[model samples]
Target: GDSVTQTEGLVTVTEGLPVKLNCTYQTTYLTIAFFWYVQYLNEAPQVLLKSSTDNKRTEHQGFHATLHKSSSSFHLQKSSAQLSDSALYYCALSASNVGDNSKLIWGLGTSLVVNP
Candidate 1:
């Protein structure tokens, strides 16, 4: 079984300040992919970043995440936080080798609040 963990339940950052959303995982599965999904107030969750190769960084929009297999982490980072960056972020793990139906384990999600 695989599981994702988002340490911060809530993160607050001033506009223009750097922000990091810590994400870690524990799993025995070999072939896996990590993803960071963001959901705005009233919108469906959208894939922010995805990483399958170990030690490679994935970027989308204004956010970036590096998947470190050695540390089992894929922390999301943004150079500068903006007001529109406020959202609920979820860390998920997917094991593609499990038959034709890949299972995804999702974290409890962290809420990011950007202030002006």
Candidate 2:
């Protein structure tokens, strides 16, 4: 079975500091893609980054993550934390080019809080 894991249940940072959110995944199938999704309070979840290619960085909205197949990790990072960046983050896995199933295998999600 394919699965995603996010070790942090909650994270807090001062604005202007850096932050990292750990994500790891396991999959039995080949050709899988990974995604990072962000959802602010009362807002729908939206994709922040995605990568199918190992070791390549994917970034959006000031957040970035790199998928490393060798390590089965896709940890998210930001150079600087902003108060507006506080949100819920999820790491997810999707089967690519080999399945009719469109649903993503998602982690429990990390709640990020940035303070002034």
Candidate 3:
């Protein structure tokens, strides 16, 4: 079984400051994909970033993440925080393998609050 974890329950950052959402995962497979999903207030959850290749940086919108297989980490980062960046962020794990149990394992979401 695979699992995703985000150590921080809440993260607060002022506008223009850098922000990072920590994410770690555990999986038996050597190759897998990691995803960062963001849900704004009253909005449905949507993928903000996803890893397509090992150790390669994947980015979307203003966020980016580099999946590190060696450390089993795929932390999402933003160069500068914005007021509109406030959302609930989820770290999830899923494999590209052909299995009936290929469901995504989601972590307890992290609340990102950007202050003006």
Strongest candidate by TM-score: 1
The true-versus-predicted C-alpha distance at residue 73 of model 2, in Å, is 0.5
The positional error of residue 88 in candidate 1, measured at the CA in angstroms, is 0.3
lDDT of each: 0.91, 0.89, 0.88
Residue ranges of candidate 3 with Cα displaced over 4 Å = 96-100
- Compose the digit string of candidate 2's lDDT tens values, residues 37-115: 8999999999889889988888888888899889999999999999999999998898654655555799999999999
How would you encode candidate 1's per-residue C-alpha lDDT over 10-95 as one tens digit per residue?
89999999999999999877689999999999999999899899988788888999999889899999999999999999999997
Ranking by lDDT: 1, 2, 3
lDDT score, candidate 3: 0.88
What is the TM-score of candidate 3? 0.92
Error of 2 at 48 (Å): 0.8
Misplaced by over 4 Å in model 1 are 98-101
| Pairs of residues clashing in candidate 2 | none
| Residue 52 in model 1: lDDT | 95
Better by TM-score, candidate 3 or 1: 1
> Who is ahead in lDDT, 2 or 3?
2
